[model samples]
Target: MMTILDALYLLVGIMFAATAIINLRDSLNSKRWKSAGFWGINAIIFIFGRYLPPLANRILVIVMVLLAGLGGLGRSGKPETSLEQREVRASRFGNRLFIPMLLIPLVTMLGTFAFKSLTWNGALLIPAGSSTLAPLAAGHDAGNGAGGRRKPLVWRRSRLSGLGAGGG
Candidate 1:
């Protein structure tokens, strides 16, 4: 009875882990240890939270808050890119940079419909009640790849039909 949410959790865990690693490598940042700890704990929670006791999860969250309140999370004082450099990049990318942002919703809608009745080995691919949420997560995952690959026209038509069914 695995669901796409499980996969999404793994993806989130990986992202947090990467953030933790980057913070840990910030040699110039005096607070790197604390920042890395915060992100590392977050990674553990995302990956293993479902298996952890609720009380344990709460305790971990409290610890994260404490770290943040104690000034644990922060970036290195030295900017990775100067303001001028950032402006140059932004100008180069312009509106095209927003394509990924726009694709999130489109992909979410399509993925919801596509995954609604999907299954693997006789088990539902997405939990019965999470058609929208699971696909939204998948859409965010798609953002990382900068991909806006289109599903078949049949899927789009099917979704449209379903939408119409709900309207009247």
Candidate 2:
């Protein structure tokens, strides 16, 4: 059983995914306006639904349905020519290319794990007396108040030695 917040999160995630797919489809086909108003309303519900009294989300849903109906009736009647059909064919080819793009997320996940391991080993390989880690050692020593002096770590140049010059 999921909590209300969990359900709402799932609902919002699905709506956003659907909106992304619709927008991509519209872009490929060169459509002027992608109807993402439903997604906008879903985002609002995700943010403010908990604060409102009962039935607020349902009322919003009803309003969206009415708006969609009105928008459907407002489309201009345009006959398609062979040129438009060729454009649609090209768009379909573009849509087919979208599937291979899934490899990007897979590669990113692999790279993240590999880089995390490399960074872990790099931190472990830091030699004692290395100037690069002097500030970190000082910060650790200050935290414990080394040599019986209980002075708090001052925010001076020593505190920032390990931070490279490209601080920005």
Candidate 3:
């Protein structure tokens, strides 16, 4: 039972892996344009998909597919270039931007894990789980009156205190 966020994260991970594989294939085939285009699509997907909903995600995917298809076909019309020749030409402009593109997912995963660990104690109690410490979990106010409705513990950043506040 993966949440939407979890599924999105997995999708992003797979996209990055696919991009890396495509990059490697392009390197071996002397297709630098394909590699750059794939990398560009990867960046666009990551940024747009992370910030937008499924509708936007689908739109971005469609746009990337069209762009990649057109760009790849367009490049095939040019003169055939050797791998070394392409590398020399591309490197002349210091266009090694794709190298940092690989780190986006790595940094995202690290930051997610770090934030979860720091904020949630590395445990997501799914309400029905049998845990002795479930009562202490955030938003778990079992006997806090108000017709048994659980009240979330709000934290005041200025005072650094937890106040049980009901969302009225």
Best by TM-score: 1
Every model's TM-score: 0.74, 0.29, 0.27
lDDT string, candidate 1, 76-114, tens digits? 644344457656766877787777678789999998889
Q: How many residue pairs collide in each prediction? A: 0, 0, 0
Q: Global lDDT for candidate 1? A: 0.73
Worst 10 residues of 2 by lDDT: 159-168
Question: Higher lDDT: candidate 2 or 3?
Answer: 2
TM-score between candidate 1 and the true structure: 0.74
Worst 10 residues of 3 by lDDT: 159-168
Alpha-carbon local distance difference test for all models = 0.73, 0.43, 0.42
Backbone clashes (count) for model 3:
0
The lDDT of model 3 is: 0.42
Name the runs in model 2 displaced over 4 angstroms.
1-11, 14-34, 72-168
Candidate ranking under TM-score, highest first, comes to 1, 2, 3
- Give per-residue CA lDDT, model 3, range 88-168, as digits (tens): 655763534333344444444444444442323444522222222222221122212221233222211111111112111
